[model samples]
Target: MTRYRPPQPQSSPYISKPGYKALNEELKGLWKTRREVTAALSAAAAEGDRSENAEYIYRKKQLREIDRRIRYLQKRLDVLIIVDKPPTNQQQVFFGAWVELEDEEGNSVAYRIVGPDEFNVEKNWISMDSPVARALMKKSLDDEVSVQRPAGPIHYIITGIHYTED
Candidate 1:
């Protein structure tokens, strides 16, 4: 059987070059998370001896996790390439392009295609590797496309597309 270890948190990215600067910014934010966790740990430790201090142990665990993430981000930031602009062509879908879709039922949904690192489903963002994105790639506005999902093949029409920094 596979071990119970959880998957490491994914890096946030939107381009192939890798976003070093953004990763640095993310590491900086994580440092703040570490600092807050450390303070909590100290406060917990100061309450009493170590044996029965659940708060101390809990906070220490939290701090350790935070530090692990911080260290990874620090190392990862060194390898990413920052992408600050879009491609010259705007007529076709490309990475970072916001695509609005409508199903045959006429329900509309919009999503921004980003690198594997920056997929936020709730915000209507998808990884460029996603099937829908794959099917939509190189398709012009108003093009019709279909994706074969587990639920069955779903068809959509590209209603609109735009490239804007939101």
Candidate 2:
């Protein structure tokens, strides 16, 4: 099978105020953890031969992961534009809007439109660049949106829209 893959498109550079704060906090915490890991790695290296040292190998892997995430967050935070206030027109769906949708089966689902870097499935926060969010953008109450999925197209009606910190 062919394993070639194309580069993905760049995500939107807009983030909510809370999302920005969270990213900044994470970057700071990662730096602290990296320092601790460096110390542990050095200690492990000093113990003896490095080839058989499990602690040293594990610490090295941990440090690499930390450094990767740190670099990503640093670059992302530099370009992110924080959207702290609600739009002048709150009737439509926009970035950081809490949206409620009713599906064909009459089941209701709630989601928040957020930046790609801060999307949390557990909290139903979707990335603004996601298919559903793109369909919902600029849509008003009672507006219908259809998102194309791998299986088929799913339709939804905009039941509610709100702008809240949560």
Candidate 3:
């Protein structure tokens, strides 16, 4: 028997316009790949015994994974709200805003608050549900915010907030 586990909290149903388009393209690509895999499986099945055909087994597994991802993307895309425009109140931090923060030690860092689907650490894009993003939400320039992290509490001052790319 499998161990019992609680259901996870639902992620925010928000995505950037580019993210939405990328997901749609991925779904389409997966469909094409699935068709190719199905054809390969058929060819492999005709060549040997069902139980001993490694090529058939691999193709079947690949097709199953592709189908699973296609299902997930279809469901996720249906509910995502694309945020293509900046919020009316640009003075405060909001979704898709690029925020610059300064720590007590005078170090500075910047991050863009984006949907969970598009958060990329390499680009300094943070998910809206993250602790830092949550603390900065609705905060204005010069405002001090504290975030409770696993390492402990950290304070930051909002140095800049911009809705457009810089």
Candidate 4:
């Protein structure tokens, strides 16, 4: 029997213009790849015994993964709100704001506050729902913010906030 799992809370639906475009392109690419996978699956099925065919089994699994991603992307794209312009009040940190912060040790780091779907850690983009971003929201430059971490509370001073024209 399968375990019962509750549905997750809805994530923020906001996405940057470029992020939205990238998702749309990914959906389009998925469709094309799905078609190719289906064709390969059919070809493998034709050459094999249903019970013992590795090629057929592999192709079927590949197709299932592709279809799952396509379904998710289609649903996600329908609800995303694209934020193409910077907020009117640029001084305060908000979604899409590139914020620079200095830690207690005077080490500086920059991060862009973005929606969950668009957050990229490697690029230093943090989800708005994250503890650090939540504490930073609506906070202006020179403000001190504290975030709760597993290790303990960490403090930062907001040194700058910038918004880009997307």
Give the top-scoring candidate (lDDT). Answer: 2
**Model 1, 15-106: lDDT tens per residue?**
54434446667788888888888888888888989779999988888888888888776666555455667878888998888999999999
Model 3 C-alpha lDDT per residue in residues 1-120, reported as the tens digit of each score = 889999988988888899899899999999999999999999999997979899999999999999999999999999999999999999999999999999999999999999998899
Report the error of model 4 at residue 5, Å: 2.1
Per-model CA lDDT versus the true structure: 0.80, 0.97, 0.93, 0.92
**Best TM-score among the predictions, by candidate number:** 4
Residue-wise lDDT of candidate 4 within 1-166, one digit each (tens)? 8799899989989999889988899999989998998998899889958679898999899998998998999999999999988899999999999999999999999999998988898999999988899999999999999999999999999999999643
TM-score leaderboard ranking? 4, 2, 3, 1
Q: After superposition, which runs of candidate 3 have C-alpha atoms over 4 Å from their true positions?
A: none
Candidate 3, residue 69: how far the Cα is off, in Å: 0.9
Show pairs that collide, candidate 3: none
* Best-first order by lDDT: 2, 3, 4, 1
